[model samples]
Target chain A: LAKTTQPISMDSYEGQEVNITCSHNNIATNDYITWYQQFPSQGPRFIIQGYKTKVTNEVASLFIPADRKSSTLSLPRVSLSDTAVYYCLVAVNAGGTSYGKLTFGQGTILTVHP
Target chain B: DVKVTQSSRYLVKRTGEKVFLECVQDMDHENMFWYRQDPGLGLRLIYFSYDVKMKEKGDIPEGYSVSREKKERFSLILESASTNQTSMYLCASSSSGTSVRNEQFFGPGTRLTVL
Candidate 1:
């Protein structure tokens, strides 16, 4: 498994875009970058995922550079409710030898204010 | 929606007591996992079962044992609860296949406190 490093905390305000970046220096070719969001007292929810380039969904966008060493999760028009802890993980998908174990680090805490 | 449900939202037990945390997934997923979350350590995998009657130990599985009797259920057993075992327990399930992204769906979590 590729170790992931991200900011310990970030601050944002309403209507602003929040971008969290994760660096995985030893990322493997088959590893994919995935982001998850967790509110207090709740399990983490899947936000978005990408292998390379850019992938956007109804909630967020993931931009992975050509190098694949790092990836960024972009949240558009953030609100106070968007405040939560965001986890970035690099894991091998279904085909690889991994058996669906996710290693979560102390994720970045996004605090959104009014 | 994929639903994963834990037996309890909060539980309190005494030291040396037996503890069992149950999880059930309605999506018929092939993989079920147990994890514990602490203040700063994030989530650490305790155990996971890829199929019924099969199990695998995760990063922190010393004090825990797991059972997968049926396809939809996985159980985490703590033979003797300790204060250090108190934390939020999370259960997740994901389908098995060759898809590129196998996102795990999580339950609400159970907060266990050992006295």
Candidate 2:
């Protein structure tokens, strides 16, 4: 399993673009970067996932460099409701199974100010 | 929409008492997982089942056991609950296949307090 490092906390204002970066220096070949957002008193929700290059969803965009050593989650227009803890995980399955038994680190907490 | 549901939203148990946490998924997913989340420890996998009656230990399987009698249901049992076992327990389910992405659907979670 690859260990990931992210900022402990980040702050942004309304309508600002917030970019959270995660560093995984020892990523494996089959590893895929996935991001999850967790609000207070709720389970983490899948935000976006990408292998390389860029992947965009309605809510956010994922940018992965060629080395795959790191990735960035970009929120186009932040809001008060966007305040949550964001997690970056490198999915690595055990014995070719679909379940990665994902390692969730102490994620980056994004605080959106009004 | 796919849904993963737990048996309880909140529970209170006494020390030395046996505790059971139930999780059910409606998506017919082949993989079901049990995880406990703490303030600084994030989410740690307790156990997971790939198929019916099949189980595997995860990162933090100590003091916790799981049963998967059916495909859609997985249960986590703590033989003797202790105050340290008190935390938010979350359940998740995902399909089984090498080609499928590891997008798990999570339940709302069960907040258990052991006194």
Candidate 3:
């Protein structure tokens, strides 16, 4: 498991793009970077995942550089409803290993203001 | 859609009483996990089961135990509840295969209050 470090909190307004970066200096080659979003009182949901380069989904995009030391999660045209705690996790998701055991670090809380 | 359901949304228990938090996943994922979340501290894994009757201790397994009697069900047990043991418990599941890209589906969470 690769330990992750991210901001404690961030503030953004409606329609503004929010980019949360997570650094895992000790990330292993087999480790994959994943981002999850958690609303109040609800469990976290997977946002986006990427090993390198860029990957986009309906909700967000993930950009990983060649070094793989850090990755960024980009949210486009943010709304107030997007305010939530964002968790950046790095795990070795190889099957039969520890796929379900995700070590979640203190996530970055994004507070979107109107 | 993968649906992970916890047995309760809220639970209250007395000190020293036994508590059980149940989780069931509909996707028949091969791996199931138990995690507790706190205010400042992030989610901490207590236990995980990859197969039937197979379990592994996670980072914070001191005051918790788990059971996987069947493929879709995983249970977290607190033999003696304490005040400090009160927190939000979450369950998650994922499929099997070769890939570090598999994502986990999480339940709504069970908030246990020990008084």
lDDT of residue A51 for candidate 3 = 81
Tens digit per residue, CA lDDT, model 2, A16-104: 99999988776656668888899987878899999899999999999999998889999999999999999887754456554443666
Per-residue lDDT tens digits of candidate 3, residues A21-65?
988766656767888999998899988888899999999999999
Docking class of 3: medium
Of the true interface contacts, the fraction found in model 1 is 0.50
Q: Model 3, B15-93: lDDT tens per residue?
A: 9999999999999799888988987678888998889999888888998899898999999999999999999999999
**Candidate ordering by DockQ (highest first):** 3, 1, 2
Best by DockQ: 3
Per-residue lDDT for B32-70 in model 1, tens only?
A: 899998866777889988899999888899989999999
Residue B113 lDDT in candidate 2: 99
Cα error of candidate 3 at position B66, Å: 0.6
- TM-score of predicted chain B versus true chain B for each candidate: 0.96, 0.95, 0.95
For each of the candidates, the C-alpha root-mean-square deviation to the true structure, in angstroms, is 2.6, 2.4, 2.9
What is the C-alpha DockQ of each candidate?
Answer: 0.52, 0.49, 0.53
Listed in order, each prediction's TM-score against the native is: 0.91, 0.91, 0.92
Instruction: Score chain A of each prediction against the true chain A by TM-score and list the results.
Output: 0.87, 0.88, 0.87
